[model samples]
Target: METKFDSTADAVAAALRELIVGGELGGGERLVERDLAERFEVSRIPLREAIQQLAREGLVEVFRNRGAVVRTLTAQDVEEIYGLRVLLEGDAIFRSVKRLDEETLARAELVHRLLGEAATTQKQGELNREFHALLYGACGNARQLASIRELRAQVERYERLQNTLLADTPSFQDEHVAILQACHERNARRARALTAAHLDSARRIVLEVVERLAA
Candidate 1:
């Protein structure tokens, strides 16, 4: 059976993932174990385990004795992540349309509601993740979904950074609604095109934001 510590550790991991994706904790920020342990109301052991898990996900880097830090994304990381996003999500949308059932589409609609709420409140980054995951899961390709999910997590760090700082970017809700509409119509081709376009737009916006921050 899972202990209370296990559950607490998982919660802390999720919360930290959100902070990272939301850019509350910026890139290269040091992760102090004891501080996090206190914040999460847990002990050091579980906190260390959570950090280790994040490291395996490529979202954190653990130094031998210096402790863990958020990984700093390079331009190359953004390029590769977006490139893979286009290939995987674009194809997944196409496949999903063919296999998607009414039930699945309805679930997707609900997920989009969450996305919209997130966008409206400027808390939609995580909801955006759920929206995409619902659509991708429809593809029924385990390996492909796994690969794309990893890429999504990697790029999301940058997306959060961009979204948090930009007051002028287009509404992410609208972008997601357009994709959902395409899926609702079962227009596979159009969905594929939109998926690619959405990712491309996100890449451009996020990269520009990163550049601005650097400047």
Candidate 2:
């Protein structure tokens, strides 16, 4: 049982990352180690380890004497994150199409259903991330999945802005539906192209939001 519970630090790190990526934790927020340790019901050791991990991931920055704060993205950071998303997610789609199996297809369909439901409930941002994750989940390459996951986390702030600007927009659903249909048809090229287009659309909205936010 001790061994089973050994990864306390890692678990805390993942939880914090998810919170930040899900926008439950916002940019420029300061993280107090002792406070977080108490809040998470863990010892300082694991809490500090977790925060260090987040620091490495660019989610948090450590100051010599000021503690840690959530990293804020500049305009350049926004552009770079979106650019990486296009490259990684686009490649994942191309690879995922060829490796697509019954299990993967089913997962995508389920995610699609959840996305639609999320839209109806006005939780578009969460559903959008789920949809993107499902699209790349079948790539069958651990490193690729990990890289995409990191990029997604880094861009979460921009995504929130995009979702706000496009509130109640069903465009994402339509885009996702087209991509899934292409994958179902075994059209790898079409899937790849559609994924690029999907990223392009998101890039446009996010860029505008970033500009406004920066201003």
All candidates: TM-score:
0.80, 0.85
Candidate 2: the clashing residue pairs are: none
- Displacement of residue 214 (Cα, Å) in model 2 is 2.2
Instruction: Summarize candidate 1's per-residue lDDT along 10-118 as a digit string, tens digits.
Output: 7788888878876678888999987888888888887888888778777899999888999877777788888888988899989888677888778878876755444
Q: Least accurate stretch of 10 residues (summed lDDT) in model 2?
A: 160-169
* Total clashes in model 2, counting residue pairs 3 or more apart in sequence or in different chains: 0
Tell me the TM-score of model 2. 0.85
- How much is the lDDT of residue 95 in candidate 1? 89
Off by over 4 Å in 1: 1-8, 107-122, 162-178
Candidate 2 per-residue lDDT over residues 100-163, each given as its tens digit: 7877778878877776666432255666667677767778788888887777678756666535
Note the Cα lDDT for every prediction shown.
0.76, 0.77
Question: Candidate 1: global Cα-lDDT?
Answer: 0.76
Candidate 2 stretches greater than 4 Å from native: 1-6, 119-123, 161-168
